[model samples]
Target: MNKIKNIHILILLIFLISIGQMSQTIYVPSIFNIAKELKVNMEEVQKLMSGYLLCYGISQLIYGPISDKVGRKPVILVGMMIFILSTFLILFANSLELMIILFSIQGLGTGVGGVMARTLPRDIFLNYENLKKANGFLNMGILVSPLIAPLIGGIISNLFEWRMCFVFLLIIGILISTTIFIFLPETCTKKQIKNSIFGYKILIYKKKFNYYLLILTSGLSGIVVFESNSGVLLSEMGFSNIEVSILFILPIPSIFFGSWYIGFSKKSFNYLMWKSVILCLLSGFFMWLPGWFKIMKIWTILIPASLFFFSAGMLFPLATTGAMIPCKGSAGTAGALLGGIQNIGSSFIAFISTFLPKNGQFSIGMITFIIGVIIFLCWWKLSRLEKI
Candidate 1:
């Protein structure tokens, strides 16, 4: 019965995490439609993503420490309510400014789930192997959002309107909130610390934690750079919203395969980490090569990008588990720092991509290559340190 109950908890946690992530990319296919309807430019529409990501990251900082003091369930419930309300209000937003504000608020609410989703696994699963399996399943499940969100958003926007995307999100928010209130239990059993900064200070001083954090951050930022730019780049290539959305699905399977492979294989984490680093470097080089030669076809982008995603699939679960293991005493704060900083890093990358030359293929490829280099250097540093 306890095992069955744990399975239920894992499923619910996956759902909670998915809703937060789906909110980020669900409107991607609707970017052009949103710009057309709102009388804004592409850059302005892109700000909506950056704005949401910024708040998503910032809100985690608050939710993490508070959830440590309070229980996970209440903090998550409050955040879901905020998300649902904001998503509903977004339907009525007629201007870009208002839309941005509401979307950011939506991100703020989802940030609760972000911190809790990761923290709960640590709280409930005491065994390192169990935690690793939980994280593997969690990440594989979360990857589904990116796979389908754009397709669903495109179909919805193509049939109805861009605002309908929020209608869908609002519904998801309500459902997730209901499940949390009914099903999720208080997983944080540790005595609450009076000063939240105590956790932060300890984690910040740990060399392994810092290195793992950078490895996670740089890898995720590369993906964000691709996601932030891909919609516009594909749209400009004369693909319809539906077609572009279909194309977005291409790289996801690689992620699934990578995650599954890592779970079943008996390879050492250090071996997998090195293999992922090599894949990332090669992925970056391929992503850049096609653009450098003036080839800008969709395949040119998708093929190499798929390789990058595959590398991420291998890297993310390992890095996340590595970063959190030592900080188990402060799981909530550690989760907040991990999720918050990565999102912020992605946001910064996305924001910077906006200023790059509009030759979408070249700019995106170059940025990805740079990100690959960053990951390599971080991994090199991490390899020299004591293994986690």
Candidate 2:
């Protein structure tokens, strides 16, 4: 019975962690539909993602501390309620501005998942090996959202309308919230740290943690920039919505492989970090080289982008575990900062990508290259420092 319960909890946590990414990506295939329906331009419609991401990232700062003070369950429940309400309300938003507002609110709600998913694993798994295994498994499951969400979004948008996408999210919100309310127990045992600032200071003071955080942020931002721009780029290349959705799935397998490899490999974290950084730099080179010669094709984009995704897959788990393991006592705060800062960085990059000239994939390639360079520099600095 205890084994069965553990399995159940793991499954639930997977769902909880997946909600944030699912919310972000499921409606992505509908961006063009949204722009046309709301009489907005591409830049304006992209705000829906940027707005949600900004609030999603920022709200974790609050949820993380509160979950530590209160319990994880209540904070999660409240966030789900907020997400459900906002998702339902978004279905009625006829203007881009209104939709952006509701989406941002929805982000605020889903942000709880971002904090708790990482924190709860720390709370439940006392052993480091067990925690690392759980995190790797959770990350593998999280990858499924991006794999399937755009496909679903494309099919729904093509058959019905984009608003139905929100309807689907509403249903999912109700089910997840209900399940959590019934089954999830409060996992935080040490809630004595009342001052959130102290927790922040503890984490921020660590040089290793700061370096890992920036490395994670830079790699993740490349993903956001690609996802933020890819649909429109593919559409311009004459692909239909469904086709674009299919193409989005192409790079995901590489990510899955990278995630799987990290679990079994005996390589030092530093070695793996360097390997991933090199792959990203190579990925960036491929991404940029094609655009430089005006020979950008579907394969050029997808194949090179897969290299980056593979690197990200490796980077996320390593960087997260490297940063979080040392701060186990302040799991909630550390989880919040880890998740929050990365999303906030990605949100900033995504917002900026919208303003870049839409020049046959040059913008995305350049952005990816730039991010790779940034990651390399951060990793070099981190490599010189002593491990925490």
Candidate 3:
């Protein structure tokens, strides 16, 4: 394939994979809507989202090395196909249990897309400058999904019905998979394909990589906690579905702006990561402290939460890029490991956030504070080790 063709295909690839992710988020407000329609508890429907996340996070480990073994194009094609089928199942879901099952499969399928989305960039761009640009583009693609999906969900659910969301996703998934089958060429080399699973195992045993993973683990835990539970929080506070949609957009502006500036800057990843980590910790502390005197309100929650994501918007790319940088031979495996560990960390935090006392703001505050402390300690250790 020609270079221009490859670049276009890559962009399409990123966009399609991103849209798959956008399918998941477009329904945050719809969770409450779905629960109400199906006569299921709202929190139960919330678990559908959580279950999707669990599969989304863990399945990356499976798909990452698989892509390394076979090829990026095939893995991506397979994932999209699975997602397409899952969405079809969801469209017919009348019971909540069926919805959760469909959501899990949707998650499992898109999980591969997420892994390949990051890994493909590394395959395409070898130079640090180009690689950084690729990472920025990848982040942008993913970030834009959440920005637009909720609005679309609100409109579609209000005008037609919630089932249209799944119908739309199903069509999009099939279209994306077909495009990949027709367009994308293989990126992984034959040498890289030999016993890729063994390579994945070896990469996991690397000690230095653990520090980078820890940094990601700590930061993402905070983000996941908010992502999994924030919908319910807002709903419980009496925000209507459309109102929740409007409020959901509040966080993305800060995240996008912060990432754009930092991602383009020439600052070292180590410095950026540390600075963002400290900001995250501070945000967590401030978020927690406000509730102690019972001063917590919507703005108080949104402001600090946005700040945490803003810092995350800065730090996450660095942590992801940094973790993969140290991998000498198996970049795909390394990418997978970084992503997989980050998901595991996020899931752990989500679980904690779920059971935390919802009686008052104190529980949520405490969880955020603890996550911030963990991130701070991890960043300090990483800085010391790197002599940064």
lDDT of 2 at 147: 59
Per-residue error for 213 in candidate 3, Å, reads 1.5
lDDT of 2 by residue, 1-388 (tens): 2556656777898888777778888877888788888887866777778998899989898898888888788899999999999998998888888888998999999999888767887777766556666666677766667557888888988999888988888888899888888997777765434437468887888888998899888987888888788887887888888998889878888888887888777777778878988999999988988888887789989998889988888887777777778766778899899889988999999999999877687889999999999889888888888342
Pick the lDDT winner: 1
Q: Per lDDT, what order, best first?
A: 1, 2, 3
| Candidate 2 accuracy as lDDT | 0.83
Candidate 3, superposed: residue stretches over 4 Å from native: 1-10, 191-195
Return the TM-score for each candidate structure: 0.97, 0.95, 0.92
| Candidate lDDT values, in order | 0.84, 0.83, 0.73
| Model 1 RMSD, rounded to 1 decimal | 1.5
**What stretches of model 1 exceed 4 Å from their correct place?**
190-195
**Residue-pair clashes, model 3:** 0
Clash pairs, model 1 backbone = none
Candidate order, TM-score descending = 1, 2, 3
lDDT of 1 by residue, 149-191 (tens): 9999999999998889889988888988898888887777646
Looking at candidate 3, the ten consecutive residues that score lowest on lDDT are: 320-329
Model 2 residue pairs with clashes: none
